[model samples]
Target chain A: MRAGLDIDMPPSNDPFYAGLGQAVRIGTELLAALIVGGGLGWAADTYLFASGPWGMVVGLIVGVTAGIRNVMRAAQNWSK
Target chain B: MEESPLHPFELHNYIPINLFGLDISINKAVIMMWVVVGLAAFLLVKAGRSRRMVPTKLQSLGELLVEFIRDIILDTMGKGGLKFFPFIATLFVFILFSNLLGLIPGTYTVTSQIIVTAVFALTVYAISIVMGFILHGVKFLGILVPPGTPGWLLPLMIPIELVSQLARPISLAVRLFANMTAGHTILGVLFGLAIGGGLLIGWLPFAFTIAMNGLEVGIAFIQAYIFTVLTCVYIGDAFHLHGADDHAH
Candidate 1:
């Protein structure tokens, strides 16, 4: 009694919306990774180690790398 | 009177209740959630009540939404994903309704609250993590290691992956909250300009306000769609660790 069993392409079909969604997603994906990494590093610096800027520096490096990986992974999902 | 664009987001409690030192006050956002849940329930029940061969408009719309969600789950998580249909469907419907309902002027967008979105993100992430551990036991840790990584890079890759994993819920929560908050803030600014500019020069900003509102509606649908899709993808990853990796690659 139901229709629309085959509606498989709503997300990929509409370029305007799909692009907007993907763009928004990727932007935050990158930022969130950085934030998490840096936050972790900053916490370690403040709480655990009296390490003068090294913990944060290392954390930011991991954050940037993770951010790139996230962007790449998200990009791989595109229809192109 | 010129009001800040963010003035709309302020919460003035209707009824403040403190239990065990927890403030669970009733606010616009709380009322909006009740309204959204009630409306969604009423529509869905009415739509599904008459399961006739010739489906009515509401029934068709409901079917379309269900199938759309089913397709997302199937595409990401495969046949096994059907078991999650109830959770996934509820999440999709609740978010879609909340986003659309919030677009109405004078109504609070419940999702605009970081705490609300964070709860959803945390719940989804926790489910995936718990399910992963249950299915794979110790091997769930393997998810942190991407396939085909050289042994030498294991130490470096593990930390990076850990950070990325932690970022998933953060991104999920921030994306929805930021989008809703940003969209509403733009609308508020445009509306402020429209009012303050008066009849002489207000029409331009007013027209832009209408246009922005239309765009915001589209954004509402897109944000909801993205959230559901990512939820599926994350859960699917838990279902089969390397499955999504292969598909995406």
Candidate 2:
């Protein structure tokens, strides 16, 4: 029981748990940024402007960039 | 005989209640929530009742949980965060318990539902936003702009930061919901194959189901941990605007 308890002890120091936590977080951060940016772009195209395909195109690009930026920030935290 | 992998996720109301046209129904998820709250309260209260220099098992577990959550608050929010111990502790315990408890064969996973996770995420995000406004007033808007940015880039940078900021709650909700849903779906598919395969090839997928269940347990713990850490980080950012970018070399 003690050994089992030690597995989760100070997750920041435990390689396996920390590594797993970091991985899931980074994956979601990238995806979420993309979803937000793209969704906003789509909404703008549909509601605000009658732009055809252009709005979505710009939104996707921004989404990808934001996703990468999020991934970088998450990585920086991991390295620290 | 074919069954959808998502079949288990469907909810059936036990006692349907409509109040002011809102469907507030008693279902598996709702019952599970009550069970989780009751069990957690019982365990923690029982643990607290014991006063001994030599701690009992339950007492030690309670202490470890407290110290773990305390360390998280201290690391992210600093000494001032001790005020939020109760909030953080409740979030940790509730999430951790639900995630672990949902793994049982007959129990429903409350966190697997997008609505449940979304509500929790929105509440946390709203609290951070309100706290920032109350503490820093109008200056809380400065969070949209990073610490080191020239005037020329402000136009482009602000929109990008704005999108990322809006994505916070969305990411938090989607992450937990997707993980739990996907994990269970895979388990369901594997178990279905195991059952349908009969005595010959059934053992293989059955074995994988067991392995995946083990992995899911680890996922459960990691998800709860990440949720707590991010919650702390978000609130901490409200406490100190532009603090995260201070040491950028």
Per-residue alpha-carbon lDDT of candidate 2 for residues B160-239, written as tens digits (9 for 90 to 100): 88878888899999999999999999999999999999999999999999999998888888888888888888887788
- Give the per-residue lDDT digits (tens) of candidate 1, residues B34-58: 9999999999999999798878778
Q: Chain A: TM-score in each candidate? A: 0.81, 0.82
Task: Return the TM-score for candidate 2, rounded to 2 decimals.
Answer: 0.94
Docking class of 1: medium
Q: Identify the candidate with maximal TM-score.
A: 1
Interface RMSD of each: 3.4, 4.6
**Over 4 Å off, model 2:** A1-10, B245-249
Tens digits of lDDT, candidate 2, A1-76: 3443543443566688777777788788889988998888899999999797788888878877878877787677
Which candidate tops DockQ? 1
TM-score of model number 2, chain B: 0.96
Whole-model lDDT values for every prediction: 0.88, 0.84
| Residue A3, candidate 2: alpha-carbon lDDT | 44
